[model samples]
Target: MQHSTSRWTMLAGSAAVAAAMFAFPSSAALAANATLPANDHVLRVCADPNYLPYSNRAGQGFENKVAALVAKAMGRKLEYTWASYRGHGGYSNFLAENLDARKCDVVMNLPYGDHEESYTKPYYTSSYVFITRKDTHYHIRSMNSVSMHSIKIGFESDTTPETAIKLLDLINNAVAFHVASNPQASPRELLQAVQDGKVGVMITWEPAIGDFLKDYPDLQVARVPSEEYGPGLPTVGYTYGMSMGVRKGDTALKHALDKVIAREQPEITATLAQYDVKLLPNPRHVNFPNQ
Candidate 1:
């Protein structure tokens, strides 16, 4: 449960190793979609085939719906370059396979300000949350509420929640389960642990909790309050802004996407609401890049 390794490193290994190991799809295959009729405008999106609440091959995730909305607003056809980064050793080579190799023009969801690629202005913000059965009545809204010595909490190993638990000295009483240990360790299995009484509570990302709540009304989630980083400054713990990704130096495409995001903001919110995604409030008087 207590491992001294960063989650990002545990998942992606080293950049050099990832580049050397992943076989980039051929240029021909990447450009195949470009040959469509000139009149047919298409937005090629790179996405995972099995990741849920984000994307899947069947286009069921919220990101898929957002992509479709963007395409429609721009009067284009939606196409996907289904890439399985999880299969390549549970790490994502998104920038390489999706953008560098020209497999897709854009990635639907990526952490905003990611240096790996140019990101459009963030459309939404999210954070980690605590999930527990409604009957437990364990009102754990923050790390302060956790009884380090008595209450047992569960979280995906090598995630932000585990890090927070360790920082708060709760690792000994926490159950850290590695999702990569089993490729199928999705939200369903994680929540099932709490439902089966194997774990008292589970700390996971909010998006997954939102999706699961629809089917399991017996479960409830508590949003983690923003942590004070310094005097007069507080930031949401494990929270991040999410945005669409395009290749570096693709300024025109980025600007066009920015316009689309600004114009279709309402539609995007509605789409995310349909999936029960918990949205963070936008900061006031904020300025985004290229704005």
Candidate 2:
């Protein structure tokens, strides 16, 4: 739940909360609204100014690079509408306040399957990964071990790792970090906890922590297996196709954005590689390749 679903929670809280924030017409209606037309001379993007590996005010994240490509291909200049992904507003409805409100026209890292908006074609897909300090030799690639019960692990709530840990009765040895938590960089907080010896392992969406690995050179990563996607109601999967989110029923804009995605895919792939964000090798047969 890093960049994509981490942006969620607000999407998953409850049906009433979800439906209250959107204008998903039974058909196309946004085309009739004049307040936020799509064909403007600028590509207005919504992003977190402090969230690294995704976006920031400095235009240094992979999403920033991808958005630049989209704007360039569309023959428009790029403009950002900054939004904080976390802190202060506890579980803020970022989409309602931004994209749906026309404050911005696109949101990258919107995981596939989000029903609140009409999203563009996926630019890249990333998986959940296991992170451990090299000095500890955690070497854990799967969540099925009996050793799981003995390790102190930090896992995101409402995600595959949480589900697997719960199913195996390993919750006692685990600390849970909510993607919807308040007032701090939750992903970095967890990793810092591990580096400080508060926890020995962490399971999180790779991009959320990938770019920050440079600060903790001793940290190592392994993809959490696909089988850990968990069970029961409201389960998010192991791998997600990352796309761009625009207003619901905004087909004109959606189509325009799709063309950019299809055309600049090679550049997008290269941008992701710059951040150590690998595209999934296989959807169902995901593996933890050596870096």
Give the winner by TM-score: 2
Each candidate's lDDT (Cα)?
A: 0.67, 0.68
Q: What is the lDDT of candidate 1?
A: 0.67
Per-residue alpha-carbon lDDT of candidate 1 for residues 1-291, written as tens digits (9 for 90 to 100): 012221122221111112223344577865774464433388888887777777888889998899989999889999888865445434345456666677678887655655556789888876667788899866777776844346788887666565567766888888876653444556677788888888888877677657767788778887765564346643324565668888788787789899999999888998999889888766332112233
- Score residue 55 of candidate 2 by CA lDDT: 80
TM-score of 2: 0.81
Model 2, residue 81: displacement in angstroms? 1.6
lDDT of 2 by residue, 17-61 (tens): 132333223223334444554557988898888767678899988
Evaluate candidate 1 by giving its C-alpha RMSD to the native, one decimal. 5.6
